[model samples]
Every structure is written in C-alpha cells, then in structure tokens.
Target: MIAPPARPDSLVRQDRFTTDESTADVAVVIVTYRNADSISTLVDSLRSEAAVSSIRVVVVDNNSGDGTASTLAAHDDVIVVAGEVNLGYAGAINVARSRIGATRAVLILNPDCVVQPGCVTALRAALREPGVVAAVPRLHDVDGRLSFSLRREPRLPATLVDAMLGARLPRRPVWASETIRDVAVYDRAHSIEWATGAAMMMSAGALDAVGPWDERFFLYSEETDYFRRLRSHGLVLYVPEARVEHTGGGSGSSQALSDLLTVNKIRYVQKYHARSFVTAFHAVTLFGEAVRCWSSKHRATYRAVARRHEWSNLLRAETPRPTECRDMGSVVIPAHNESRVIARTLDALADLAARGVVEVIVACNGCTDDTARIAAGRPGVRVLDLDVASKTAAMNGADEVAELWPRVYLDADVVITPAAVVDLVTALADGTLLAARPASRYDATGAGHLVRRYYRARSSLPLVRSHLWGAGCYALSEEGHARVGRFPDVVADDVVVDAAFATDEKIVVDTDPVVVLVPRTPAALIAVLSRNYSGNRDAPATTSSTGTLRHVAGTVHGPGTLLDAAVYCLFAALGRRASRRTSARWARDDTSRT
Candidate 1:
C-alpha cells in the first residue's frame, strides 16, 4: 500500500462541504484560509474571463474565522463551502475537487490571485492538447513584473549549489538552480517539472487519475507532489498566454511557513527518491538554511531541519491540533483468520492514523492466515497475535494494550471511513455520551431476494437505528469501558457494549454511514444471523429484555412492509432454532469474504 502523505492534521475534521451541480465546463476551485478581504477581487476577476459563461466558481473556505463566509455570500453565482475545521491547502483542494461534478476541467486558484481576461480560455486551450493533463499560467506580481513561478525538480547537485550560493543568484546556470529564471522559457508554452501552485488548470480526468493531493505538506510542497503525480499520467504544459496577477506574501513570508517550506522540500525528496538521495537532499537544504540563519525565517528553517524527527510536532504548532480526546482515542479491531478482510478494515483506519486522529490496534486471534502481517503493514496500525481463536479474547487483549480512552471496537469485515470515525469520536467526546457508532448502510447487492427483503425490514426498525449493536463498529469512552469492563466470551461484542450504556449515554453519529455487507446466499445469511442470535443469548440478560417480537413488530407498518416483516421474522426464528440446535462455535458468513 502507498503510504499516506503525513501533513499536520490534514484530515483533522469531517469536511462540511456543500455545493450545487452545474453544467459549467470549467470549475474555478479556490482554497482560502482567512483571506476574506482579498478573495472578492479574485472571484470578481474571473467574472471578466473570456469563457466566464462556462466557468463555475467554487470557493472552499478552510474554517477561516474571518468574514470569508460573509464575503463569499455576496456572490450569488459562486458555490461556497465553509469547512468546520482548517483542512490545510491540500485537504481543502480535495474537498473542492469532490464537489466539481462533471465539469470538463478544474482551474485551481489562490484567493490572492486575479485572472486576466482570456486566461481561462488559454488554459482550456492548452488543456485540450493531446497527452496533456495539467496547464499552469504565468504569474505576475501586483507590480506587473513576472514572478519566476516555474521550478525544476529538486536535485542534489542543484540543491548543493543553492546552499553554497544563495537561491537568489540572478545568473545561476539552469543545471545549478532550482528556479527556472530564463525569461524566454516563459515567453511561450512549454512543458515543466512543476510550477507555482498559485494558478494551475487540470482536466477533470487528470484530477480523477491523480487521486488526492499529498496533504502531508499543510501549506507548502503539496503542489509539487501533485504536479509530479500529474506528470505520470501526461504532460504538464505551461501556458504563457494565461496570465494571473498574484498577491503573494501571506503564509509565504511567515517564519513558521518558511520553516514548513524548507522541511516539506526535504519531505518531497524523501517520498520519491532513494535513501541515499534523500540524505544528500536533506544535507543541502539544511546547509542552505544554516548559511542564511541571520534571517529569523532561515533560523527557524534551520532549527526545523535540525529537529526533523519532530516534524509532526512542528506542524501541530502551525495548525490547530485535534482535541486531546481525539488524540487519545484508540480503535481496536478483532480479527480471527480474517486475512481476506483485514486489509480493507485497516485501510479505512490508515488515514485516521496518518492524521494522528487515533491509535489503531488489530488483535489477530488464532489466525493461520496473513491477517497479522497485513494489518502490521498499514501505517500507524499496531498488530497483535493472540493465542486463542476467540473474538472476546482478542478484544480483551487489545483493550489491555490500548491505554487511550474512547476505544472503538471494529469488526474485521466492517469498512468505516476516517471521516465517519471522526464523527463517532466527536460524538463520544461529548461529556454526556459514552458510546457511539455511525448509522448503518447495508450492502445487499448480491444477497438472496428473501435475505435482501429481511434486511430492508430490519434496517428500517427504530431499534436498529437507535442501538449500537448492529453496526459492526462502535466506540466507548472511559466510563463506557468501565461499564463493559472486560469483554465476556460472547458472540455479540457490540451487544455487550450497547447494553453497557443507557439510552441517553449511547448515540449513533450522523456522518458517512458504515457499510455493512450482507451475506450473498440464503444459507449464508442465516448462518450470520444465527451467529448474531447466539451472541445475543450470551449477552447480559438486560440486552435480551427487548424480545425478538418487539423488534420485528417495528418493521411492520402497512401491507407493503408486511411481506418484509414476515421474512424478517422467519429469518429470526430460523436463526434462533439453528443457534439452539448447534453447539457454540464461530459461524461467520465467508461468502462475502470470498
């Protein structure tokens, strides 16, 4: 698996993005943080573009407490999404990309930049070139002079030269300088390694192929990383005719931002190059900062490079860190011979771990398969090999090791996204709620007709919606953990957690729904239901107070659902009978696993 780029809490919050669907051919996506005063000029400038009629303006305000919301509200034609938390530049761009629908191309612009007339038209023309995925516009400073926005890939030889003689060396040779300063190069369209991210255009296909921006650099090298990825698919063309006047010097001038810039340059090198090359790149970058230490920003950069191991801490200082409770939460996944599904579960949690959102521990019990190996390969995920083949034993073992509070216990087959996990963690952070889980979304695409009907009826029941037991994923705070103490040897671990909390103490978070896949065949469905029934029998007596009849009763309202309710009841009865007749053993539906 490709390692997720580590940015300072890039995925810190569940993005609260809302936008409209438009038939516009081009989407102008602007990611802004605290630039309310300057964004209006940029947005208004796009209105005068030659192809303004085909352009849909999308502004993603990254939780800027400034009046950016009010400033954007004035533009009725623009689509504005205000995030609840600061998702950094790359994260906000990702959110904006998701909302672009079927637009032909996306032009990413900084709020501080104004596009000249015909800029979008020229960019679209360049984007239409065969084998071209990205087109970057030539940027001019507010004073109307060219801002050397083009750059060469960071090479050890060029970096060393820059370190020996400062980066501003006017006549530095092309091979020794990282910046592309030849005036002739910007006079006409050409290909480039990368360009300044202030104004860049990409086809929608390029955006889809390149996937997400490497959010590891909160404000710096993310664009470089993305540009490199875009180059892998096709050419990154420079469109000199496309002019954008940029107002620089906000984050770029700050000492902290400069520190990040230096560190992220080294990070970009480390991600793509061998260790030997990364070592050389780091040494050169550090030397350059050391020589220029007279300036406060350079000193900050030097110190940042010196303490490279604490980069995450440095990033935390720059960005608002997640709540202490969020940092302290742990996700415990119990896997027993689950090689088939363990990777899927861990992949969901990888982003959470990369963002420092939670600690993940996968306790593999009696696994003859490669479950433990697969889980260990995931970033920020811990793996344990338990001797017994018991789910309760695995959970208990994981709980013993997980010192953090608000522990989330996830089933190996369940696929819960990082955003949904954040929602559950957020809900559990509330002083009143001790336990939480996301709403359930059952995938019964390949299930038998009767089984699908049974799930349809069962999913509509108020008891299922309100209870935390059926979701396969659930979280418990310290107090909630004390109530459930040690997981008993029961089939339904979720049921135990659910029973531990009173009605007011538990909640179902309204985030992205947790996808729960139903068994494919009728027999397989019954086998899973039978296992659930067996778990229910082993749960505390209080959990059984609500009888099967009561739950089935809620599924029936009119004649339409009456058939579904009957199927649900029949399955429940059959599962109960099967559970009573069969000896206590693990009975999972392997059909979905296959």
Candidate 2:
C-alpha cells in the first residue's frame, strides 16, 4: 500500500545554547548564511537592546560553509542552532522559534541588518497593540536612504499594472502598485498588508494561530504567505519609530533566487486565490518576463513559467545523498592556443587531481604552443591533442574519453578551486539535476576603463552570473549529456547546451566561483563581445538582437546604472555591427589569453 506524502518540515537537527528556564519578553531570531562578517554588529546592537528589556537572542545558521555557526556559538547570551541541512529562511525561523521559551513576541531578522537604539523596544510595543498581529520597523540601507519596504496585498490588478507601467511611476494609484511609494506613508505608524522579511516582530499568539511559516515557499515568498495568513487574525502594523540598517544582499543573490522570487509570487496566488486568478497571475508574470526575456534572469523565469510541473520541485529542501565513487568525477578542459593561461588553470586543479577527487583532461585542439606539455606535466592529468581548432570538437573529443557519470567541461583559461569542484560534483551525484555550474567572479584587473564599466553593468545582472555559460565552466551528468547529445558544430556551444535544458534541470551551484579575467583593453573587450554576437546569431537563443537591446535598456534603474547601461549598450551595438561585417572566424580575445 502507498503511504501518504510526508510533511515538508525540513529541520533535521536543532541545538540550543542557552538552557535558562526564565522566559523573555521577546525572542530575536536571526537566520544566517555565510554572514559571519555582519553577525557581530547585529549581535552587539541586540546586546545593547537587552539592557532596556528582557530579550532572548537566537541565531539559526542555515548550513553556511563559512564559520557563521562558530561565530554565533561564541556568544554566551545567544542560543545557536547549527543546521546540518539548508533549512532556508522560513524553515530556519520555524526552527529558531521552537527553541524559545514563553516569549510574548518573536522578532525575525536578517544577519546583515542592525537595529537602531530603542528599535526593538518600539517594535515590541507596537506588536503588543490592540488588533495588531505583527509589527515592522522602517528599513534603510547603509547609506541611510529609506527603503520602500511595505507592500499591498499581491493581487492581479496591481501585478498587471506594475508589469505594464513599471514600478518607478510616480503618484501611481495605490491599488495598481504592490509597493508603497509615498514617503508620507512611512512617516507615521500605520497598518500594512505586508513588508520586507528582513526585520519584523510578531505576537506569539498570532504566530500560533497562523501556524508555522509555509516552508514550501522556500526562501522568497514564505513571509508573504505568512502575512496573508496573519491578516485574517489582525493587522500588520508599521512602526516608524523603529529603524533597521540593512546591508542588503547579505545572504547573496543568484539567478535561482531571482527566479524563485518570481515563481513564488504566482505560487502564493495559486494557494489562496481561485483558478482564474491563478491563470491571470501566471500570464501577467510571463508577460513581465517576456518583456525582459533578453535578461538572463527573466529568460530563466520565462522558462520556469513555461514549464509548470517541473518548477515546483525547486521548493523541496531534501538534501542530495552522497555518491559511492571515491573519485568524485572527471573534468575536461578544452583548449586551442591557451598556453599563456593554461599553467595557472591547470595548477588550480592540481590539488584535486592529486587528491583523487577529480581526473583532469586537457583537450589541446590545434595548439602550436606548449599547452599540451604544461597540462601533461601535472600528475593525474591526461592531454588530448586534437587536430581541429574547434572548441566544441575539443569538448567532444574529451567526452569520448571521459568515463565519469557526472563530467565537468572547463575552459582552459578559467580558474576554479578544488573545493568548488567537489561541491559541484556532490550536487550532481544524486542524478536529479542534469546540468550545473558554479557562480562567476570576474577579475577586472588590468582591464581598461570602458571594459571595466561594461563588466560592472553586466555583473550587476543576475543572469550573467547565474547562467551556465559565461562562467567559463559547466558540469553535465550522463543524463544531461543524453539530452544535449553530441557537441554541436557552432560557435555558441554553451548557448546550445543551455537551451537544451529547462530552468529546473539546471542550476548555478552555490560555491566558490570560477575566476574569469576581463579583457585588458576596450578593443579586446569588443572583439570578445563580437564573438558573443556571432555565437548568438548562430545559436537558437530565447532572446533576439532586439530583445538584447530591451534587456540592456531595462537594466537602467537609476542614475548610477544609467551611465553603465550607456557604456554597455554602446559596446553591444558596436559588437553586433562588427560581427556582421567580419568573417565567421573566431574573434577571440588574446589579451586575457596572453
């Protein structure tokens, strides 16, 4: 007989630091992810707040690879729960709250945020008000600029209007926008539908009535789902007297997180609203993504919305099991004339190869230099001297010899650490995912001013870092290879591989990023972008040249991004024009290669 499905409570282990029998007036729960750098300041401020009121501090570390748990453990007044698995934000909050004693109110906080003097006291006071289920503090960035933290109930009309008119429209009708833009509204305490989850205080009774935060929403919309539930009980009050200095993006940002944020909005509507509303919400979301589908993130979201049944698995918190193989996998490096950069790249993988964690293969395709000798000199490294100069041909040649189930295709010029390769291999060991790549960290060292400015804008886009391409490396499971088939004879082989899989089938693994060196000069940068343009022209991408223009135009959020966008657009236009006029030969950037 088939058993019923299990509940999605993902917390496997919880540890309490303080065993005090005495209850506190409020419990402050901070969810951390590699936030050891900022956790000290937050803890210091909360320690000061403890002088005015009885407060119990609790920190739940969400399986951070950094020493966040150890840092929190050093605090005697704090209760720290070092999670074995990643219990996202909502699940971490639920876990932290369970360890608290009889507290009147519970405060949720981001690790990279700090509360000002009397802020917690104000929030606790506001939470105690009549008919108030939750209270939120006014949030500001480190620059002291006010954040539009409050939002209206996420309905179809607001979503549609925001999608059409965009969010920057002034004096927008309150019903047509989810974000509350009026500064006057933030001056005084008032009721709100919901606010940012970076910092909030909720009554213990309201929390109990609403039940635990829905962990299925994962990291993004779980708070929205909770607040919607809280509205049934009472109001969510905004306390202007309370302020939090937020160093946003503390937990980090990725294409996956951005896609999660977009898809979960529709998921929320689907949970409470009718079928028609759900369909409309989905359509509005797709329209928004469609408008910006040139952007990597929006393109990814468009794909996510297009594939409905698959994206729901992203909400699952089940951890991947370890594989039986002692040597994790094989790594294939495809090189043409990368002699200058091949040593550094091979040196980065030497430790992993020597440790028997990964077997390294360097496919030197049509190389005249000592690229083959440099790689062959390294222990546990195999060199394939291919006659053709095609990158895809080199990849296919290495694949013919690669015996591992999950194989990594690395560019000869990219530098990736052994730890990141191990993590990436572990992520693919379970065979649930088809493709994965570590995040990218671009080194702008020796880059010209125009090149620097162009990459500055490009790096700000979540898609450039999140997508499998551009990061200089991507891994594919045996199943992924079956789907992608053989390496195509195209300049945009990465694009072809990326297009073959849906958003759910691929991921940008959270690990040490591969280092991609920027072009040293503006001309070299344009030459590389010209190659990209040629590749995009040859490949079957979701975006077009016009879509690319709109995507770059859509990135202009304010004055700072405006200058960057202009530089980026100028280079993009030049690159496209150059690619059209030039021959179909590889317009490679020898600057970084040298």
By lDDT, the best candidate is 2
Weakest lDDT window of 10 consecutive positions for candidate 1: 10-19
Q: Which tens-of-lDDT digit does each residue in 1-594 have in candidate 2?
A: 999786554221122222476777788888888998999889888866776767888888888979988887678778888888886787778778678778878888899898899998899888777899899999999999999999987778889888777767857878888999888899999998999889988888987898767665668888888888899999999999999999888858887787788888876776667656776888898898888866887788787775543453454343322222357889999998888999999898887787677888999999998989888999989999999998999999989988886889988889987756776776677787889887677788888888888987787663564368888889998899899989988887788888888766787765566889988998888788888888877777766667666766766758977989889989988888888888765876788866
Off by over 4 Å in 1: 1-22, 50-52, 316-594
- What RMSD, rounded to one decimal, does every model reach? 23.7, 14.1
Instruction: For each candidate in the order shown, give its overall lDDT on alpha carbons.
Output: 0.79, 0.81
Q: Give lDDT tens digits, candidate 1, residues 335-359.
A: 9999998887788777777666789
In model 1, residue pairs whose N, Cα or C atoms come closer than 3 Å (at least 3 residues apart or on different chains), thus clashing, are 6-216, 7-216
**Per-model TM values vs. the true structure:** 0.55, 0.52
- Backbone collision count in every prediction? 2, 0
Candidate with best TM-score: 1
